[model samples]
Target: MRVRVDDASAGQRIDNFLVRVCKGVPKSHVYRILRSGEVRVNSRRVDQTYRLQLDDEVRIPPIRLAEKAAEPVVPFGKPFDIVFEDEALLVLDKPAGLAVHGGSGVSFGVIEQLRRQRPEAKFLELVHRLDRETSGLLIVAKKRSALTVLHDMMREGKVRKRYLTLVAGRWLNPMQHVKLALHKYLTEGGERRVSVNSEGKPAHSIVRLLKRWQSYSLVEVELKTGRTHQIRVHLSHLGFPLCGDDKYGDFSLNKQLEKQGFKRMFLHAAKLAFHHPLTDQLIELEAPLPPELERHVVQVEQTEEKEYG
Candidate 1:
């Protein structure tokens, strides 16, 4: 089958376009076909990273798909809290436990639900991602032009992202800079994990102490370089693991805290600032700490006051 790329689908990577076009096809199979030169654009072979342009002719090879079971449905009634919106973008306060887009093992996620809610929306794509366990501000591009410019800004380090988190112990330094090289590896059980390695990608984070308790410290972290699991791995390596972080954290402490009703990850994406892709105006946004996390912080402060008073 062949498709002519339209404006709404322009600026998206070919692989993503194929994944969206081919219903019920596994992602690996789509990638395999692309690598094997089965997929073509304008009668020429293009790699997955090739972005589709308006009026480009894409040729898709037919594949036999197995009978798949019906997947679960996302609640169309529950829409994400929109923090900011214009013709170019949508900023959302993403809740924890929801994947950004469907893939891996998840069949549906925020993007899918958003598209379902607004079928008339021609172009919608994630600007960046947060781990499913982490919650906070997330950006979605409403236009292909917005997506392209925002992606360029990310690579140039023009976007400012900050997070709030509670660490396992009292932080001594008023400010700290962590520059760690992180390497990604698969566990024996096939689980993905990141660790600090000598030969790895360089990551930088600046952390500032916000408050201190006997057993935990609240801190704000600014990411200088974005890498998978960068914040969690860096803090864990410093012996100040994030409170309630399931991976790269203190497991025993997590279980103890869960029993005490502090069950979720303490990390939250509190702030985001970047220039508007179209207007070129600075866009600054913030999401107040979720009620649950705020309550936990108050409890810790109260306990410390009782002890020190």
Candidate 2:
């Protein structure tokens, strides 16, 4: 198979490009072909890290995806809660338990569902990722230019993203700054994990108390540097774990919460603000808390004395 790189695909790593072009194929198999010189760019063997330039022609060997048990092509996701939209962007209020894109154990995610739903869309891609357990504002780029600019804006701190989370205990400080260096590592079983380490990327989060109960506190966390599980790690390191955070929370508490019918993490991307990548107009969007999480807050309050709001 021959694929021509266009503006939408330009600047992408060859490995990633191949993954998209060869959907349903295993990533390991894709790398196997690349390393064995079965794939070439512009008639020359290129390493997996090679970034594709505009007009580059790629040659791919024929591939057959191993069949599995009969299942639906797309996981049948409802149209996401639309936050804002234009020719250049599609902002969505993503719900918990839905991954941003497909890979690793997930058959298909929001990106695949969006593509399936809008078959006429020529270009659509996720601009940023939210954890599968996280809910709320997620940005999707409708145009490559918008994706590039949004990424640049996020890296340069030109964009603002805030999250709401409920953590245990009375977080005394009204406002606190957490600057922790975080390192990503894979577990022995190869699952992804993050932790605070001296030799790691610096992460910053400004947390403000929003509401409090005797047993829990709701805080708004603003990240200065985006990192995998930054908010969860930071709060966890501070001795306040996000309620129902299975990865870094009090596991006993999580089990108890689950028994109480409040399952899933209590983290949300509640607010986002940024300048238009193309029009230069400021865009601000807010996603209301999911009803389950709201009810969890109410449950906590009912079980304890309200301290502040």
Candidate 3:
């Protein structure tokens, strides 16, 4: 494969840049190629740590794969909401109750449907992920180059995501940060959950209260680490669970919400901000609350007003 460093990635390390550009190629093999001169920059062999300058031409030999690229293993459907799309990437507004990828007995998800929509697409990859119950902007890469770049950006904590949720308690503090350590473990049902632990991975979230009511509060959360259930578990542990969070909320309240037509969780991925993998330009994306969630919010507000009045 041949690649040229563009202006956006002018000052990155050569190996780092290469890793971003040559995704799905194993890291060990990538380094081996770099060490053995199979990979070259400007036609000269360089170490993995070599700093990359703008306009550097890199040449890499074809990799011998132990197995051919697999066929589409995921099943397909037709209900996909795309927010943005280009040759290099696609941004989707995934709805609540839909998984991003198939797992734990799920036959298909958003990615599967997307694959079916564009079967000829090569190197389609998920840049970041959202939980099955969380809905909003999801980034999908159409090429290996874009995938590698976006994944690197995610690892470096450059991707910014914001979620809007209705929590169970009244939050008087409009601006507050929720810092907690999260430990992940699988349940007997093979579902993932998190808990506060001293030896767990460090997780931080900045939560801002957007609105308040007698029984629930609408808040915006910014998660620093991509830990599973970090927001739900942390906020639950903090004594204010989400309004419709069945897994981490009062059972009676959840039952009440169910009666109120809240059929799904109230969490929503409201926005996404990241850098364009190919152009290095900043990208900001948004997804509005769906009808169900919107109605639930209005109902909760009305109920709260009645109780307080």
- Number of the predicted model whose lDDT against the real structure is largest: 1
Query: Residue-wise lDDT of candidate 2 within 71-115, one digit each (tens)?
Result: 659955687789899999989999899888888988899999999
Could you estimate the TM-score for every candidate?
Answer: 0.85, 0.82, 0.76
* lDDT score for candidate 3 against the true structure: 0.82
RMSD from true fold, candidate 2: 4.0
Strongest candidate by TM-score:
1
Task: Return the TM-score for candidate 3, rounded to 2 decimals.
Answer: 0.76
The residue-by-residue lDDT of candidate 1 on 54-170, one tens digit each, is: 999999998998988877886785888999999899999999888888888998888989999999998889999999878999999998888989999998899999999998888
Give per-residue lDDT, candidate 2, residue 165. 97
lDDT of 3 by residue, 1-309 (tens): 788876446666777766767766678888888889988889999997887787899897887766657654665565578888888898988888888877677877787778787777745668778888888888888766687778888877898989999888888887788778889888998877778997998888989999987778899999777788888888899888987776887778889878877878778889888888889888899999989989988888788778897
Could you tell me how far off, in angstroms, the CA of residue 235 lies in candidate 1 after the best superposition? 1.0
lDDT of each: 0.92, 0.91, 0.82
Model with the higher TM-score, candidate 2 or 3:
2
